[model samples]
Target: MATYSEEDYLMLSGIQHFAFCRRQWALAHIENQWNDNYLTIAGQNLHHKTDDPYISETRGEKFIVRAMPVHSREYGLTGVCDVVEFKKDNNGTQVFGKSGKYVPIPIEYKHGKEKTNHSDELQLLGEAVCLEEMLFCHIDYGYLYYGKTRHRKKIEFTLALRQELNQTVLEMHSYWQRKYTPRVKPSQKCKSCSLRDICLPELLNRESVNEYIERRLSE
Candidate 1:
């Protein structure tokens, strides 16, 4: 396993963007350019409500912790989990100042319905893996709470997903190191992309006016 120093750590949240579209990830993460669309704004608002770092609530055997910071040196990633529920269980590891052993299950909050691309699932898996590394415990599953659907979707950290997540992170690091922004690949995803205006996928490879006119006249 390749390990990266803390300085080389990339944002864990970037996995979603990278999984969705490599160009979008490059534009936002490498170039540090971000434009807020409706989806982005809604996600920001939802996170604001769940991101109170100081908030922690106890409900019987479970403790809900908001805005818990997590990182994995092995994976070279860092980010804040929206919610971490420490449930009391005999199989769980002991926590500081806690009465008994507890298992940490991370929950990520996102906007809109579940995407077919599995970007959201990859992000949740990243959080779970980070928590597993930090807590020295095994995490079998996590949760994704969609604002639009108003439901929680359970995600299992299977071997396939983990492998995909790891490969995705490696690719993201390669792009980050070279400061390379990939060219746009036209797809339906471009319609909802916040960076569509910035990317100009259609015009990026456009022909000159003379060439266009010649092609049209020939047709």
Candidate 2:
């Protein structure tokens, strides 16, 4: 496995963006353009609540840790997990300064209801991978908590999913190395994207310069 220097590590949360749209990922992470829409704002607020560094508590056999900073040298990624619960398990590994063996279960909080996309799951898996590297333990699964549903959905860290995550991180690293932002592909999904105005997907899709200018002037 290869290790990344501190400056070369990409954000773990960027898995969601990359999964959603390669162009979107490059635009934000490469071009350094960002504009928050309502959904993004709400999501940030929700994460802020859960990302407090001082929030940690013990409940019976479970110890809850909030805003746990995690990174993976193998994947060249770094980010904070919203919450991580260390559950007591007879077969688990020991945590320093804590009493018994425990397994780490990462939980991520999302603002909206669950969607058909694997973005959330991928992000959660990234955290699990980071935890595994930091703690020297195997994580079988993690959780995604949706604010709208007020529920946490379990996600198994399958071989296929892990492979996909590895591929995604590899792609991200390639793009970062070249500082490349992918060309836009316009679609119905563009309307919901927070960076639509900055991306100008519609303009990029226009076949003629006159048509693009006309559309832009009209808007």
Candidate 3:
């Protein structure tokens, strides 16, 4: 398997943006454009609540780690997981300095309720891939904790999901290599996009004055 050097690694968080929209990913990652909308601000605040790296707590058989750094050389990705819960299990791998074997379950905190899109799920899976690589263990499941609903949704890390994640990372690296920003395709989702004004999806949708004049001349 191929491995990426530290300099070549991309942000694992970009998986969510890439899954949401390629143009969005290019704008933020390539063009370095970002805007703070209410949704984004709230999301940031929610992350702030859990982004502390020094906190680790033990609850019964579970050891909870916050803001754990993880990376996967195979995917060329690195990021901080919001939470990694190590549940004690006889079948799990032994954690260093811990008494028993435990399963590493990544838990991501989302600001909103569950959406129809797979962006959040893909992001969580990316984190799982990193943990699996860093810990040298197989992770079969993860969780997404939503602030809006105050609920945790479990996700299965299946073979198909793993394949999709690998493909997504490959595409991300290709785009990064080319430094490409894809053209805008306007949609309802644009309304909620943080970089909507900078992306100008609405302007891209409308015909330019020059184009209108050209069409009139042609007519």
Full-model lDDT for every candidate: 0.89, 0.89, 0.88
Give the per-residue lDDT digits (tens) of candidate 2, residues 1-70: 5788989999988899999998888878877778999999999999999999897899999999999999
What's the true lDDT of residue 191 in model 2? Answer: 85
The per-residue C-alpha lDDT of model 2 at residue 196 equals 83
Query: What global local distance difference test value does model 2 have?
Result: 0.89
| Model 2 TM-score relative to the real fold | 0.91
Q: Candidate 3 lDDT, tens digit per residue, 9-123? A: 8997899999999988988998777889999899999999998888889999999999999998888999999999999998888889999788899999999999887788889
Any idea what lDDT model 1 has?
0.89
Regarding lDDT, does 2 or 3 come out ahead? 2
Clashing residue pairs found in predicted model 2: none
- State residue 86's C-alpha deviation in candidate 3, in Å: 0.5
